[model samples]
Target: MTTSVSIFPIRHHGPGSARSLEHALSQLNPDVVLVEGPSDADPVLPFLTQRGMKPPVALLGYVNDDPARAAFWPFAAFSPEFVAFRWAARASARFMDLPASATLAGERRNDDHDDLHSDPLRVLAEAAGHADFERWWETLVEARGDDFEVFDAINEAMRAVRADAPPPTGREAQREAHMRQTIRAALKDGAVRVAVVCGAWHAPMLDVDAFKAKDDAALLKGLPKVKVTLTWVPWTHGRLSVGSGYGAGVRSPGYYDHLFTTRSAVTERWFARVARLLRAERLEASSASVIEATRLANTLAALRGRALPGLDELNEAALSVFGWDSDLPLRLIERELVVGEALGEVPADVPTVPLAQDLAKLQKFLRLKVQPEQIDLTLDVRTDNDLARSVLFHRLNLLGVPWAKERYAGGRGTFKEAWALAWKPEFSVQLVEASRSGQTVHDAATATATDAARTAGTLAELTTLLESVRYADLSGATPVALAALDARAAGSADVSDLLEALPPLARLARYGDVRGRGSESNTLAGGTFRTLLTRAGVGLPLAGVGLADDAAATLRGKVNGADAAVRLLDDPDALRGWQAALTRLADRDDAHPLLNGDAVRRLRDASVLDGPEVERRLGLALSSSVPLEVTAWLDGFLDDSGAFLIHDAGLLALLDDWMTGLDATVFQETLPLLRRVFSRFGKPERRAIGETLRGGGAAGRGVRRELDEDRAMLAVPVVLRLLGVTT
Candidate 1:
C-alpha cells in the first residue's frame, strides 16, 4: 500500500533551516527521503556523500538542452541540508530528486524570463519592514555562523513574509509534474515512508495528485535537451553577495568568505591577507602593524561583545589602525581579496546547437565567476551594422550584459565602440540568475529584445535600456551610429548621438590645439566646425578651422555674427575671416549682431589692416549702431590687456619676472598662453626652450649650475641674504 508522505518545503541554501530539517528528519527517520531535484541526478549522490565531500560543494543539476539552465544550491559547512544529507546517507536512506528531467530547451525557456518576474512580495515585505529582506535573511540564516536553529526560524519567517506572493501562471504546473514524477519513482521503488524536502514556496504544490495532469513526456518530451556535463567549482564567499536584484545573497561577503574557508575565526587571517595585499600594492605596513590592527578588530567586536569580528568590525579595525579614515584598508583589501584571482573553471563538451543549447553553449561553461581579468570583446557588426546592433543588444539584453549606447548628432553607418571589462565574483553569480531566462542565448536575446522593442515607448522599457549603461564597461559595445539613429527615441532623439560624436570631434579639436594643427586653433573650434555641435547644447570646441557644408554661407554667418573686434593674431588668417564677417554685419543685415564687434576686434589686434580699414569700420559702427550691451561687449573684448599674450608660454617668459601689476584673470590665464606662445617659437628658439625646460629653467637653475660644477644639486638651498620680517 502506498502511504501518503509529508513533503517539507525548505529553502535551497540555509544553514539554520538545514539544521531544523535534520532535526525533523531524525525524528521521522523515514524509509526514503525524496528531494526536489532532477531525478536523473542519482549518479552524483555518492560523489556528494563521499567522505571528503566538503561542505559548500554543490550538486548542480542542469539540462543539457539546446539552451541549458542550471540550479545552484551550494552546501555550506553549517548548511542544514548538508547535515541532513549526512544523516540520510549514514542511515542508508534512499534520496531521489523527483523533478521533471531538466531539459536544455526548458532550461533555455526558463532562462529567458528567470528574474524578469521577480516576486512583488519581496518588494512589498521589504517596504513594510523598513529593512532589506536580503540582509534580514543573511543575519538570520547565513550570517548566524554555526547557528542552524536560528536559520530555520528565519527561513520559516520569510515563508510567511512571502506568503501572499502572486500565483504562478504556469510554473506551478511544471513544478507539480516534477513532483508527481518523484512520487512515481518512490512508488516504483516500493518505499513505505518518504520524506521530501524542497523550498517552502514549493511545499504547497507537492504531492502526486497535484501533478496528476502532468504528461511526463508530452509535457516535457518536446523540450529541447542538451548533453551538458558538470564539475566541482570552488565557491567564494563574495559570490553570495546580494543587492538590488532577484536572487539576493548576502551583504558582507568578505566576512562570510572567512566564515566558510577557515576552521576557526579568521579575522586575523583576513588582516594578514589585507596587510600583504596592501604591501603588494606598494603600501607600507609592518607585521606589527597588522597584528595590532587585528587586536583592535577583535577588541571592537568584544566591545560590542559578538562571537567574533563581523565585516563591520573588521572594516572599523582597518579604518582605525591602518587608515586615517574608513576608506584605505577596505579599498586595498577589496582590490586584493574580494575579487580574487581564483575563479574555478570546468571544461565544456563539444559545440552542439541542440534544443538544449542553454544547457551548454559552444564548449564553454563558466561554473563560477571568472577570476578578475581585463576582458577585451570586439564585436564585428560590419554585415548590416544596424541589424547587428539590434541582435547584439537583444542578446545582451537576455544575458544582461552591459554595453553602452550611442548616437551621432548627424552621421550614418558603423562607428567604433570601446569598453574595459573586469570580471567580479558577483558577475558569475548573476550568470546563474540570468540563466533562468532561456535555453539558448539566441532565443533569450531574441525574445528579450522583441519584448523590449515592443514596449519601446514605455517607461519600463527605456529604464531597462538605460540601466545597462553601468555594465557597458563589461561588454565592449561600440556601435555608435545605430544607437544614435534609434527611431523609437522621440523629442530628444539624436541628442545621445550628438553626445557620442562630440567626444571624438572635441578630442580631435584638442589634439589639434595641443599640436597646434587643428583648424579651430585659428579662430577657435566654431559651432559649425563640429557636425555634432548642434546636437548637444554646451559648446566645447578644441581646434580647427570651423567649417560646415556650405563654406560661403558658413563663413558669412560666422563673420557677421562677431567680426568687428576679434583678435585675428590668435588665428593666423583671422584678418580675412574677421574682415568678411565684419563687412556683413555692418551692411544692415543685423541677424548675427554678436559677431560684428568680435570680428573687428580680432582684425584690429592682428594689426594686419591699415588705419584706413579700421577707420572705415569705425565709420559704419558710428553710423548705424545697435544695442549698447552689444557694443559694450565688443569693447570688453578689445579691452583685454593680454591680447598680445594670447599664448601663455610666450607671455610667461616675458611677464613672470614682471608680475607687480598683473590682474587675477590675466594671471589665471597666463599658463595656457605661455605654453602656446612658447610652442609657436621658431625652431632654434624652440630648441632653446626645450633645453631650458629640461634643466636650465629658473625652477632648476640651482641644479643646472651644480651640474655645470659636476655636483649633485638635490641639496638644501643656501640662504643668500639675511632678512628681517617686517609688517
Candidate 2:
C-alpha cells in the first residue's frame, strides 16, 4: 500500500487548531504522528498521558555540564502540538520530533530569530486589515467550530506567505531540515499512513519528495552537538502570555482556555464567572447585571460581525453593565481571569535534580504553596516554624536562587523578618545548576557561602557574607566566614570599611541568642565586633581630618550607624572605646565642622559631656567659625532632632543670637541649611518652637510665672488618683 502523507499546519497554543487537529487525526487514523518539538524529549513523552500530568508545563532541555544553558518548550492544554501527542497516544501510533541537541548546543539566538518563523501570521492578519494577530486568529479560527477544512485554509495561507518570503537559512533552515528528516524516517519505517503536525510557516517547506535527503543532510552538516538532559517542569499561565517575554506566547491564554473548555453558553458562563469574582471581592455584581452583561456581549459580538464574543467584547460588556468608574475592576479581571496567574503541577515522580525534589518536599512540609503570584510572608524568628522558613529563604538566596526577596520588617525587633516570595519556572534549571554544590538546599547553600567567604577580598564583603551565613543558620559556613572576616579586618586600614563591618557583627552578637544559636554565636560575633571596633577607633581620628563636605557627611552616617551598633551591644567596654573615638573627633581642630559638630552632639547625647561643657563648645564654635562652617556645625548638631532645640532653651538662644547677628548675605546663603534643619521637626514641634521664639523663649527654661493656687490645689486629688496613692 502506498503511504499517504497528510500535513496538518497549526498555530501554536491555538484552541481551535487543537480541536481541528484532534478531529482530523481521528478521521485519518495515521500510524505515525510527528510533532514539532525536541526529538530528545521522546523519553518523557509518556508522562504527558499519565495521571497527574497537567497543562501549563514545559519540556526543559539543558546542557548536561552547565544547566544554566537551557531552553523551554512550553505547552498549554489548548496547544495543537499537545493535542497531537494525546491523539497519537490514544491511537497507539508512533510520535517523534526533530533532534534538539544541535539547537541546544548552538549559541543562544535573539528573540527576534526565535520568533521569525511565526511572522506569517502577522502578514496574514495585516492583509486581513486586523491590527492584532491574536484577535484576528481568534475571530477567524478559535471562534469557529471543529472543522478539518481550517487546516487546509491555514496551509494555503502559509504557502502564499512563504512564496514571497525568503527561504529559511541558518538555524531555521537546519530545524526545518531535521523536521523533514524525522518525517522521512517515519515513512521509511513501513508506515502506510503518516501525519505531520507542525508550525504553519514550516508546513510549506516540509514536503519530503520536494526536498532531497542529501540537501537536508548537508544543511544539518557541521552542526555543533552537545549532551543535553531533558525533563518536564511545571509552568505558569502568566509565563504563557506574550507580556512575559515568551517569544511564541499568546496574548490571552486564559481566554483561550475558557473558549476551549466551555462547549456551550460560552458568553453566559463567562459573565457568570465575572460576577462571581466581583462578588467575592465584595463588589456589587448582581445576577441581573450578569444577565445584562451576557446579552450585551453577544450583541457587541453581533455588531462586530463575530460569531461569538471575544475577550474585548466581554470586557466592554462587563464594564458597561457593572458600572465601574475606575479601571481597577477591569485590571483585576485581566489579572485574575484574562491572564489567570496560576502555577501548574507536575507528578511527584517526574524527573528532576535531587535539590529540586528536596525543595519540593520542604515546601510541602512547611505549608508553603508554590505560586506564580508574589506573596508577602512575615516571619517571627521566635517561633520554630517561622524561624525554619526564614532560614530556608535565606539559604535559597545564598544559593543564588532568589525565590524569596528579603524586605524590611516594619516596627523593629530582630525576631521579625519580611519576605516577598514568588516562584518562577526557570528556578527548576537554577536548582539543577545549584545542585552541583550539594544534593540538598542546606548543604548547597553552605558550600556556596563557604566558597564565597574564602574568595571574598574585602572586609565589608566578608562581613556581609558572614551576616547572611548567620541568618541562614549555616553553622558549617559560619566559621569559614568569620575566619575570613578576621583575616581581612586585621589587614584593613580603612576606618570606613572597619566601621561598616562593625554593625552586622554587633547585630549578630546581640541577636544570636534570639536566633537559637545560643552562646557560641555570641562569643564568635562578640570577639569579631571588639576587634573591628578597636581598629576603627584607632584610625577614626586621622580619618576624620582633611575630608571634603560630601565625604564628611557620608562618614557622619557611618559614625551614627556604628554608634547605634555599639549601643545595641550595650557592652560597657565597647561603649567606652566608641566614646573615646568620638571624643577625639570632637576635639580635632582640623576636622570638618560637620563631623566636629556631630561628634560633640554624640558625646552630649551619651552624657559624657555635661550641660555646661556643651554650652561652652557651642558658644566657641559659633563665635570662631565662618558663617558656612557655623551652619554646617549646627546641621550636624541638630540632625533629625528639632525637639532638642525645643527642650534646650540655652542652646536655642545661642543659635538664635548667632543667626540674628549674621550679615544679610551670610544669612541668605545659610537660609537653605537652616530650613533643612527645621524641616525635620514635626508640625506640632515646629509650631511649639515658633511660639517659644514669639514668647521670648522663657517657657522652655521653666521661668517662674504667676498661678492660681486654689485651682492648682483642686488638681492635687486628680494627680493623686492618677498616681494610685491612698491618702
The model with the greatest lDDT is 2
- Candidate 2, 1-727: lDDT as tens digits: 8888889987788776777788889888998888888887888888888878888899999998988889999988888888888788865443345466777787788524534366556666777886545556656655454455667778888888679878777877888898888888887888888889988888888889999999999988888889988889999888999899888888888878887778899889888888888899888889999899999998987898777777889889988888568776687788888888768777889898899999998998889878888999988888989988988998999998899998988633467888999999989989999999999999999999999999987777787788888888888998888788878877899999889888778877887735667468668888989988998998898898889989999999999889999999999999999999999988988888899999999999999998889988999889964778887888888777777777777777777778767888888998998898789878988888877766656554542334669868999999999999999
What are the lDDT scores of the predictions, listed in order?
0.45, 0.83
lDDT for residue 651 in candidate 1, whole number 0-100: 28
Off by over 4 Å in 2: 92-98, 111-119, 131-135, 138-146, 378-384, 407-417, 513-515, 548-550, 610-635, 653-727
Instruction: Give the true-structure RMSD of model 1.
Output: 15.4
